[model samples]
Target: MNYFELHIGDYAEATQHLSILEDGVYSRLLRKYYASEKPLPADVAIVQRLIVAKSKEERAAVEAVLQEFFVLAEDGWHQLRCDGEIERYRSGEPERKAKKANEEERMKRHREERAELFTKLTAAGAHAPWNLPIKELRERVAALPAIVSGDEPATPATGPETLQVGEPATAPATPATATQTPIPNTHYPDTNTQTPTNIGINTPLPPKGGRKRSREPVEEPQGFVRFWAAWPASKRKESRGKCAEVWVREGFEALADVIVAHVEAKRDQTDWAHDGGQYVEAPMVYLNSRKWEGAEVGAMHQRKREVVI
Candidate 1:
């Protein structure tokens, strides 16, 4: 358990009577206990050395904190609060396992649906815009049949039709040689005196504040996609959108091969595998913290795998 919740009010009230040195010693001991997920050793010297209590004052502080906050039993020095937290964590293991199983099943169903859609698109000599979110992709997939079969009206070749969908359509232009009918301005209805130009037929008015620029989907690079596919799916694999953003911002496409190799290597590492990936860093966290440079990943391994691109 590398992480634990500390209630500030509860902690402060309990330790307010202790000196600064004693307070620091108490905090250190609690961290060690939670990290190891066990009670402190029976031997006081061993405990002191673990917290680096070298000086006489430091040693006394350790003793004082232990006396008030912990109880000695045959196994070790146990703190009731720490014990309760450990028990609660263990008790929730079954619930966590079930949740993980459900998520895996949901992902499997999505893959099957996507595969069916891909087949249809491929037959039509088209492919999905993988850059779009799943909801948008699903909608597009459903509409593809009507579009490809010509049952749906084709998009107009030019003018306002060229703009994004949902923009208001205008009256088609009249041929220069033909007689024209005067169409009333529906928007500005009090328009008997206005000329055709004043009707603003060619250009639509900007939406309330201003025209909103269309935001097209951004295509992800092949390198980043491969890197992501190679990365393991775990409980900590979260914030995918933010992770993709960071990958591009950091220009990690150049280091994709090296990064993927390191991730493969770490598949066997104890920290990532421990407690079913409870300690695995989130994808966004791994990129943001630049963990590839950490000593845990060898320089030799990364350098050997670096590509020219």
Candidate 2:
């Protein structure tokens, strides 16, 4: 849902009559729609807040686009095109995984072929010294056929040494990878007397003060995103990480649609509105306490939850 292609000609055709401002609003709405992979809210005011609509004209345009392009259902405002794209992306997960596997296999074969060629040159006392520029060596090896077919590789003479060429050497232990080519681990003298140990490639030394490693970004759940959008964005919206954790930990994915709808509906209630949401619980509190279920909520929370689940 993070990415979806837009056919420029098709989009232009559909929105040709829309004003510049209206087109912009439509695009933003699509972004929010795909990002969460959820329907737009039936509530126009909530949609305006989600899309950051500030101007009177912009707010009006939100209504126009939703009316023209989106259909309001019991769940929310659903766009046929957006739903189709999201469904297709999710359904193609297996194909994407297969493509990644094929790419990795290609890289592996490339490494093995280079290793075989390297071993051949080493055994023949060829001029492919460890000190040769890696780029040049790689280029020369690349020009050669993958397996040399039904013939032996021709030995090229270097000097009076008359060393054999193209004779396969002992099997290479393993090869350097594209990401990290195996480089010589051992030091070699100018005479090239010692054989270099083909091991890990040379990695760059750390900077003077050292560098801080960065952590990977986390992908929030779609339901959590919708719930978060509905949650008031005051200082009370803390511990977002914990809230996301609890979201899945409590098996809320099944109830996410219900929870988000309930939370949005309750946003205007007396308990939440008192003291400017001072009593409006943090997301974690709201989720853990099951505040969305009103009085006598325990029985109703379970019964309704069972139906949704």
Candidate 3:
């Protein structure tokens, strides 16, 4: 069984043996030993053996309860074995193995998805905005060491020194590590001790840096993906071809200048209109038109024939 049960069984056996002694002195000694903290496992085993092998008087006293003691000892060891098995089962070894296997599968799937996303983004020319190349990312990831390794150096500098190695000399110990031992508690009179400072109860939080500072909430722009796709194509074409071109030639250039100024003043993007990312450029209007031939219709006379007859 477990350590607790084993201890109890040993105690029971010892008490039974002590009870059998005819002289109260032997029993009294055993009682004193039992009342004290029990010996360690190794010491208890040695003591048990020594008691059995000693003088005939001691042996005879112990032999009276020897049968019951042997049975209890056997049962205790058997119980210990069973407890060990239970502990092994409870340690989550089986679940951990299964979890590790699942983790590998998850990592594989993530890698595949990332690879697919990279391919798609590169194809769409979206990777340029992110600035980190895929090859550089891979190299950085590869440079990281493994999570666990057996032969890695220990924390303390206790390893053997090699004479031939071109290693830098070790620094002499400063007062830092040696002088940092814990201070022992000392009794202080309640009256003599200084009172704690009356600190402010609720000081405001300090401004955060990096990510916390940069991440501010903003309204997301709203729109449908192909919202204008259902609009009349002829009308749209005409608007683009004539109306927009005329408007631009007349005042569109001036409007562009105004838009650039507004962008610079309000949005802080000075070269927004001139930048390659800008949609509106030197080409005044974009027209998508299709030419189609059709038959002409003739006008018909509906009331002329009857008057002639």
Candidate 4:
């Protein structure tokens, strides 16, 4: 199952041991003779020539000479094996098993450390009050003044009147001035104006239709909204590790998208109006670490929230 076993024991020695040794010897002898000031023996001269020779036949002849040494030297042959099988076994099953066990223990320790840290963190910081109802959370958030409202109270402006006689007299009229004729409600002939001759004081106004209704104001609940942007709840939970800092930005994106889309499509306007305010806490966005922020919400680009707050 291991590399050495697959290649048969002492595979390197059986296959290329002689050549490998010769290459080493040849290289060393060449370095000592050619690179250094030392002069090689005349017989050793043959090695340098054979190594430099370009022909394959010449290289084979040189290798044959090296093999002769390997055959005669029992110590040399044993040296080539050199605890090969034992070394391979030591590197195999037992070592690998030990290493794997050590790795698992390391991972287990790391997990325990994280869990302990989380326990400490949960103890230190606030826990979302257990099993809080959605209705209650909403109510609490609703009580907050910062929550956006659906409609703003309209403030009437003082502007010019269209020739209506509704101004209070700035100065008292002179008592002896010529009697002024009272102005009557005159009828404009054209347009959608219907002149009513029966202009009695207590005439009820026409049924209150045919006018464009004003848009409702936006309202926000009292508290900040919690939106989970992450796909799985586990990711959200994990990010809250110990003194968890990072929450997924995806959750906030989801909340913002939903709220924005709802508003843009004008859906649930009545419900929103009933709900007190129109604002929803955008999805939970843990930007980098340590803090969660709300996503930017608006009509057109709300759907494309990858990471905006």
Q: Rate the local accuracy (lDDT) of all candidates.
A: 0.71, 0.69, 0.35, 0.36
**lDDT (tens digit, per residue) of candidate 4 on 233-272:** 3223332322112222222222332333333333243342
Clashing pairs in 1: none
Identify the candidate with maximal TM-score: 1
**Which candidate achieves the best lDDT against the true structure?**
1
- What is the clash count for each candidate, in the order shown? 0, 1, 2, 28
Candidate 4 Cα misplacement greater than 4 A, ranges: 1-21, 25-58, 65-80, 83-92, 126-309
State the displacement of the C-alpha of residue 219, model 3, in Å, after optimal TM-score superposition: 43
Select the stronger candidate by lDDT from 1 and 4.
1
Candidate 1 — which residues are off by over 4 angstroms? 146-309
Q: How big is the RMSD of model 1?
A: 22.9
lDDT score for residue 156 of model 3: 42
* Residue 153's lDDT in candidate 3: 41
- Expressed as tens digits, the lDDT of each residue in 224-290 for candidate 1 is 6876786677877766666777788877665554466567667676578667777777777778886
lDDT tens digits by residue: candidate 2, 1-309:
657778888999999999999999999999899999999988989999999989999999999999999999988999999899899989999998999799768656654454455544433334343223335657765565544421554565455355368755555478557677455434322232322443224634334554444443446877688789889766789887778878778756545545766676567765776667777767888889876544223322233222110
- Model 3 scores a C-alpha lDDT of 0.35
Better candidate by TM-score, 2 or 3: 2
Compared with the true structure, what per-residue lDDT tens digits does model 3 show for residues 21-100? 53343343233333332321233344445444356665555444333332234223112333444465457667968987
Q: List the candidates' TM-scores in order.
A: 0.47, 0.40, 0.18, 0.22
Model 1 error, position 115 (Å) = 3.8
